[model samples]
Target chain A: MSNTSAPNKDLPGTILAFIFIGVGCLAWWDTFDMGDSDSYVFPRAVIVTLIVCCLLLIGRNIIWGGGKNHKPLDGSAWRRIGLVLAMLGTALLMPVFGFIIVGMVLFGVLIIIAMFEPWTRKLAIAYPLIGATIVISFYLLFAVLLNVTLPTGSLFD
Target chain B: MENPISYFFMSWSDPYLLLMTAAGTFAGVYVGAIPGLSVTMAVSILISFTFSWDTNEALALMVGVYMGGVYGGSRTAILLNIPCAPSAIATAIDGYPLAKRGEAGTAIGVATVMSFIGGLVGILVLAVAAPLVSEFALMFAPRDYLLLAVIGILLVGSLSGESLAKGVFAGALGVIIGMVGLDPLTAEGRFTFDSITMMGGIHYVTAMIGFFGVAEALAQLHHLETPAIKQKLERITPKWSVVKRYIPLSIRTSFIGVFIGALPGTGGDIAALMAYDHAKRSVKDPSRKFGEGAMEGLVAPESANNAAVGGAYIPMLTLGIPGDAVTAVFIGALYIHGLNPGPMLMIETPHLFWFTVGALMLANVFMLIFGLTGVRLFIKLVECPRAILVPLILILSVVGTYAIQNNVVDVYWMLGFGIFGYFLKIYGYQVGPVILGVILGPLMDVSYRRAIISTRESFGDFMLEMVTNPISALLSAALVFLVVSQTPMYKRWTNKRRSV
Candidate 1:
């Protein structure tokens, strides 16, 4: 996390992968019924390969030891990261907040932050409202009109 | 081949089929011209709608979309700097420059004619060479396929933006990512630790949307204030004399496109780039304005990319192996319609082959009609503010990814990869190799495993076979030559010789 050290960017990605791999190994070991031609055989092999790859990646990172110089994470990098987090947050809340509301809110926030358009009287207030309307129309078209079921929030029920 | 006149008359006799071709062509052009919407996406969406329709009708629609989509990408490449699909990346290099010179109409006209010509050539090859080529393809064992996949990975090194090492690293990373989900040979979950969702593996389409579409949008966000494109439609028509000048180049590039396209795993994007590179090297005096706004530049990639479409189908129709993702989806449609694409297909269903050829010809004619009229409307789209367009594109990407299986999890996966893709881009890693890896990784895995198993787990035998086989040895030699020629030592030595 130290900015001066030039964080190994691949470290974060690698660690996240390790977690997934570990969880997968545990799951495969615990519940996988290895009954001759059980479906778990495929999953188990995949997990083992993943674990091997993950360990190799971790070892490679250690041996290389930040050999290639990377630019320190600047404020802009942080902002981009924040935007990613925000998008993920919205996705997480989508089923809870309904597709229309979450989509509109996310769209408005992203446009404002990413586009850097001035929040003039007609722009900020109007854009988010319009985004909401358009998204609702799309929902109706796909879900109601076209008979495709979109995630309706618990509140709607 | 099979009484061309009789085939022509048979196609002409079917009025409904003709109408369907016209509709598909029109729809393909429109969908393809739209930025962020690719031919693959358009065809895939059409597949769902055509699920209930008869095979012939479905084929007409899919083929129309396929032809249109391939040609359609050129429109955006010319009018806007953005390519509608990966194949159009080469098209944009020359096409955009011509558009910038205020000859948008002329460029579109030339592209239309060339696309039609290219489509016709591809169809001709598909009709004549498919049977012969398919036999050759079947002779390729798993080891040959594994070598082919490695060659594809090497393309990542060539395509990686600045640093060869970085590109190789990205490619390796992609291969690793691709290894996630289930293993083909052992059916083992290679990377998916335990989550049921992870066990299914990441869908290549979702990764593609994330890496290309979402990553592109995020990158565009960094330069939102760039000047809006000003398109002028004056003097749009190509002079007959000018068109005649490029006929030789167009025809040659078309041959290149079809041949490359016919090769499994290669598609129009690579064909167009290779054609452009070859044209650049081969032409002695390629007009002073080649890259800046050369007509030959526009003609070469356009002709080749469209021709590659036909080339791609050669493998699909004859061997049940897709030349590209679009054709892969087409293979699914073929399966749905109770037709299996293999050697037996030619023997059992000759009519289907003829119908497909007829469809390709009709699609080309329709491309000309749609291309000319649609250019004006498409130019207008470039003027739309990015603020409005970007959000819409995101919605489309989300919906399109989800529509693949109507699964929300896919959408989340797309968004996750999109974020990861953006970081990769900022670090100067090219997305092309990552995509190529994702596309070719499974083939590499399956083929390598099969080769190993077939050789009785003898690693030495498998290695020997790769080196001993004529085609594999040749491919390996080419790959070695490519890598060696690109090295720093070679460049330095060449420079020293030149100084002498």
Candidate 2:
């Protein structure tokens, strides 16, 4: 919420570096009680080195304003986000609805949304049907032929 | 050792083996041409599919995919600026420019020939060097591996665009993400936060799908309205004269590719970039045209990446250290096929080595045939409407990720990281370094830990030991020089010196 755009660019990198440093410090602390001959010796060194490197990178970023001007958010950003969500939703639903059903519906939706081309009747039927067949074949190849277990939705049962 | 001639004859005679090789090559090409789908994924999936099969059959299938996948990436690189795999990134630099200039066919032709030459060189090296290298590689200690992983990470500077800090940061982030799973040395969960699934850590393949495939798809959506590729279909044959002209450069780049590929943890991607950089630096007369669709640019990267495929096998067969992720998975396939790869492998299973060399040689020949005929079809693929093609790619990505472990969790992870990756890419962060981190992180962790434990209680001794070890010392010096050369201070100093 700070209007300090100067600091914002460096914040993400700094936060990441601090997180590493924090973790490294914790690793070092946990092993601090160990004797010099202990196995924790090298891990502690690696952790310490990682902390130093992270701090150096963070320091450099802060000094440089993270290099180059940050571009404004593009308009398609939300649409892209939505497409990702839709893909995730479909993947989650695959086991429940069957890979075939989920794949077909998602393929239809994605093609329509992503391409934004007006659907012809031929494509509307063909695309999903083709997509479904591909998924089903893969399901058979892995689950049946290859003898690997795939998610079989309750709908099939 | 079984006679190399007999093994070659057996491999050539087997009908099923021949069929699998052809099928694998075809599948690898198709998979590699699609943006986001890589040869590594295809080969890994093939491993799972061939898990129940015979050893020779499994090796044959995997080798076919390996050879095909490496060549397949050139298709997308030439047609679109989007590299089908990281190895093809350098290929895209000159290839896309060639396509834009209506020389797509000629570029593909040259790439195909160079790929064949590169593959042949790699196979020859594998056949001859495996025994010698395996003997030498046995001398590697955990400390040596640690230094090698450090060198691998240093490559992040060379691969990352413009900003060294961002590249290192991305790479460090990848290493941290890689650390999210179980700690190899301590057998303790480092970053899993006590969750059952978290204990398993993230799969590199899933990370790859997200980083390369899904993120790439998301990036494509922004440029959706860009005009479809309009390629002028020309004769897809490389003229003998043109081939003769670049033969010297091709062989040079192939050697570059193979040597880099033979080094533990390095792969075609690095080889191709290094080769391209070499070509740029070395070619004085045509250096001005390097990026503007230069033939040398296309030749250097393509030959190197293909040659790298062969180079990658060296470490895999000799030291049991995979040169790249795909070869790492290929090592898994080798194990599944009842072949253990290591120093003793050459002695214990010499026949297997000969068979692999033969298969690779045959696969390269198949690549030439498939590559030449397949060019027109691949170019047509670039013309497919985004509406259809994008959805299909998404589906393949999901299927590919799911096929790895048959886990929906991976799909979710892929999508999660896909979104995260998209944000990272838009912010001008390079994903390649993150991948390098993920791949090299565990190696770095284990070796560093081992080096310390081996050195007893003295951190100074541990440091001294690395500095004193000849190979480690050399690698350290090189890493130091590379980092210094890339630093902003070095650049400023150089600029001031130039102006004065």
Candidate 3:
């Protein structure tokens, strides 16, 4: 193995600092269009502070070695990506299918994606039943007991 | 004034009231234990349900839930490394590590006992020192508030994982995000970019739920195949010697909690984090290293967050100003009940004050009983398959997000933040400061502008005022000291001095 660290963090740290500087510039520019000093002062002050912090980060990476490994995204990263996608899917589908129905679909899909266990007949039967119980119980608690109006799908309505 | 004694014992006489308080505590424990279900949300929901109930009955239940919920967040933090509320972030730092070492039960026992002690200290202060504290709080000017916000933001140093600069950058990002909505003073759109949703700004709670809950779930997916840690079931309760050793530290941190919690713009979240920081500095001989299952680490934050409950009520009952978010909801609850929580509230409604004190005490006792009894069951939760737990956490986060305003946009925002936060975490940046920034950003914006306005927008005059005013000068000094203490130069100097 090479003596040097596997991944250099300084590169990413410098990149992030640049991004922060860009954000700070945008924030500072926006303040100029404001009608009054009251609206602009705080943002301007914070922007300056932010820009300074970004510069500090850049300087630190230059002064101190950050050749340490940046987190590697492997199979687990893809799984995380899938989990986020599943959540987004549920968000889009929930208003259409109602929370409970979408909730079950979510549970079913999430378990299949997250669990590496082979699709056994027992799990196939058990997962849906348990998912239904959790979703329905939460529905009752929020809608019935607490009187929170759950999102009723237009189709259901 | 009515006798405080008669009011203190008010709940004891009424079985129904006692039952209601117990029920609230029970519900609060589970609600708080669940990731994404925050105490503020629970209390806010309770306000809607208890609208028709009698005033005393509603107060009892709300107080019970408030007290119990703050303590409950530590449960998930210890068992799952996912804090149910922002206040529990500090708890997860050490509590989760303790759980990994199969000491989940012992950590929880310490948290429970310390929380009870902290709760008592807070209530005691509320009972005896509320009037004095209220008077002191009322003296704070806008400039002082800006200073307080600065102090809070600087505490990001504690949350900085590997790099302090990264923490500051994350916090600044949060501040920028917080500034997305309409300017509080000028009513002009800021960073909105003509987007309707941006005009409303981001809700810190949504950001917090996303960062801590959803982000944590996504991160857990990386280790789906890792087997669960088998928790030690025996010797769950701490011995008297162990308890006694930590009592002094608990009392000290509890004082910090009560003091911070009583501040108008701050709450248990800040209190817990600050207390954790204080513990890191003060506890020279920790049982283990701080942030690695140190008994002191768990005790400091757990005690501080609960103590904040009483600290929060000080301003609400006396001055109408909210001490924290939960108290802000409580103010709404009081208003709904046709009572104004202002200067004359205690004088006019003395019984309410006394009853709350009594109720909070009762709730703390209930929390102790409930908290200690759930270790076995909680360990099972810790030992559950990661594959199963990860999905469940995702769904729970969704449900919790949906509960807030019943809007899908909030859920979307939550998921987005979660993905973003996961990346940030992987990059070795901490998310706690970001959430803290979001919470304090608006406060900072409003206060900074107000202070400048108070000085007629003259920059030199504003600087002069900061120095001329005794309180402002003290606060400015504190901020400078905080910065100086964290510098590498200062650290080296201190070490050299100590060596000499």
Best by lDDT: 3
Per residue, candidate 3 scores C-alpha lDDT tens digits across B1-500 of: 66888888888779998998898898888889875467888898889889999988998899889888998889888987778787888898889899989899999999999999999999999999998987787678888888877777677544445556666677778888788888877779998877787888787768877887888887777666667788888887889999999999999999999988888877887788888888888988999988788999999999999999999899989988999888999889988999988888988888989999999999999899998896798788778776567767777788777876778888999999998888777767788778878888988888887888888888899899899999899989987887777777988999999899
Per-residue lDDT of B1-500 in model 2, one digit per residue for the tens? 55778776555789998888877877777667754456776787677778789888888888888898898988877875556676876787678778867778888998999998888877777777765654454456667777666655555545445566566656666776677666675566655556678778777667767776677678768767775567777678788998898888888999888887776766787688777867765776763376688888888888998888888888887777887888899888888777888867767887877788778887888888899996787676556677666676677678767766778888888888787777777766667677667766777777777776788746798778778878778767877876787788998997899699
Relative to the true structure, how large is the alpha-carbon lDDT of every model?
0.69, 0.73, 0.83
- Candidate 1: tens digits of C-alpha lDDT, residues B1-500: 56545554444468877777788888778666654356776677778888889888888878888998899888867765546666776677678777766667788999888888888888888888887865665667877776666565555445334444444545555665676776665566655656788878777667767775666557656656664456666645567887888888888999889977877766887677667756664676765456587777788889999999888888888877888889999988888788888767767777777878888888888887777775676666555556655665565566556555556787788877787777776655556666556666777767777787788978799778878988778867866865676565886897899699
Task: Decide which is better by lDDT, 2 or 3.
Answer: 3
The candidate that achieves the highest DockQ relative to the unseen native structure: 3
Runs in model 2 with CA error above 4 Å?
A1-66, A70-73, A117-150, B1-24, B27-62, B73-110, B235-246, B260-302, B312-355, B493-500
Per-candidate RMSD vs. true structure?
6.4, 5.2, 2.5
Using TM-score, give the best candidate's number. 3
Worst 10 residues of 1 chain A by lDDT: A34-43
A1-157, model 1: which lDDT tens digit per residue? 4454443545654564466456556655653433433333333444464465456555655665421344454334444555566567666776687777777877776666555455588776766776677678777755674455667776787
- lDDT per residue, candidate 2, A45-98, as tens digits? 556556766777677777755644455644466668678778978877888877
What value does the lDDT take at residue B428 in candidate 2?
61
